[model samples]
Target: MSCDNCETALENLYLFLDEEIDHASIDEIQAHIDSCSSCLTAYDLERVVKALVSRSCAEKAPEPLRERVLYSIRTVQVQITENRGI
Candidate 1:
């Protein structure tokens, strides 16, 4: 498999990690990462960080905090509407 340049592969690294890129791009990035130790290390680090963040954010906020945030958002919307005369 032909290898992609480090810059291009790293540029799409986040998209690759998030699975947001097309299959062809994924293959290209994978090939680059496989052959390039620097990019492979970077990919591994980012993948771990992403996984950790995802896992950490998996917990739901407490019900009271959620309600308070929603209430604050509604209050802001109302104030904005009043100011705009909408």
Candidate 2:
């Protein structure tokens, strides 16, 4: 991989880790990561970030708070669309 290819590959490293891309692109990105140390470091750091996010988000939601949120979300669907970048 050239520096540019490696850079792009690293930028999409999370998608690669989550297996969210097509097979052909996945193969290309994996191969690029295999040969690029900077990309490897990024991959490692991204994995750590995912782990922390997952671990820290394991708490239970309170029932009243959950109901309130669901009610507000149902009443304000536009806000949901906004948060989703639409």
Candidate 3:
């Protein structure tokens, strides 16, 4: 079932999955899915990826690695501020 207007493209579909689309766009996508089998399949694949990312990031970061990364960012930020005399 193809959309009559073909308005729902994959990029907008990705934004919807990422919760970056506005409510009206979400409504539009829902309408598109109701009519377009191809876009619906694509949307399903994106949902699977979203769920997988949620699952994978559910685990805690290792302590040393987390601290090291945070420290590096802080170091860089402080250096930048010092350079700018801020």
Candidate 4:
């Protein structure tokens, strides 16, 4: 693969990993990764990092915390509106 292909593949790495791009784009990236060891390694690293972050942030906020946050937001909105005389 040429450096241009590698650069393009790197730019779309996250989209490829997330399957957010079109099928043709996915095939193109996969082909590049299959032919380029460096691209493959980079793709693998990104995949692992994405998985780690997804798992780490899977838990939901506690109900009390959620309520407090909502309350704070409402308070702020009210204050802003009042200040603006809206």
Candidate 5:
């Protein structure tokens, strides 16, 4: 595959790894990764990183903490919107 095709494939590498895209796109990215060593290295790194993040985030937050964080975010959003006169 051409470098341009490899470039295009890398653009959606994460989606491919996550199985979030169409089969045709997955096939294209898979083919590109199989053929291009550089892209393959990048794909491997991205896959490893995603796996690490997923495992690290497997724990659920306590309900009270979660609610407080969401409340703080909403409060900030309201202040911002009010300042913007929206």
Candidate 6:
């Protein structure tokens, strides 16, 4: 594995895992991971970590907290609008 390919794959690993990159870039990264054992291992580890994080973060906020946050956001919006005279 060329340093460049491994570097690029590792650098963009997050974007690739999150499906945030363009299709062309995804294809390029996927190809590198498929061909490079080291990158593939890195990719597998990152993927597992990401999945774990996503699962761990899947809990919803408590109802009271959710309501308070929404209220604060709406209050701020109203304040901004009032300040803008709109």
Q: What lDDT tens digits, residue by residue, belong to model 2 across residues 21-82? A: 88998889888878866566556656655665566578655567556555653443343233
Give Cα-based local distance difference scores for all models.
0.69, 0.63, 0.62, 0.69, 0.67, 0.69
TM-score of 3: 0.57
What TM-score, over all chains together, does every model reach? Answer: 0.62, 0.58, 0.57, 0.63, 0.62, 0.63
Clashing pairs in 3: none
lDDT-sorted candidate list, best first: 1, 6, 4, 5, 2, 3
Instruction: Give stretches of model 4 more than 4 Å off.
Output: 59-86
Give one digit per residue, the lDDT tens place, for model 3 in 1-86.
22343444555877888889799988887887777655665566557556655665987556775565556545544553444353
Flag regions of model 5 displaced more than 4 Å: 59-86
Q: Looking at model 5, which ten-residue stretch has the lowest summed lDDT?
A: 77-86
List where candidate 6 sits over 4 angstroms from the true fold.
Answer: 59-86
For residues 21-74, could you state the per-residue lDDT of candidate 6 as single tens digits? 999999999998898766676677666556555665787455675565556545
At residue 71, candidate 6 shows an lDDT of 67
Candidate 1: where is the Cα deviation over 4 Å? 1-4, 59-86
Model 5's C-alpha root-mean-square deviation from the true structure amounts to 12.4
Which residue pairs in candidate 6 have backbone atoms (N, alpha carbon, C) closer than 3 angstroms, thus clashing?
none
Model 1 agreement with the true structure over 1-86: per-residue lDDT tens digits: 23338768878988998889999999988987898766766676666556555665887556675565556545544553454353
Q: What is the lDDT of residue 30 in candidate 2?
A: 83
Deviation of model 4 at 75, angstroms: 45
Q: Rank the candidates by TM-score, best first.
A: 6, 4, 1, 5, 2, 3
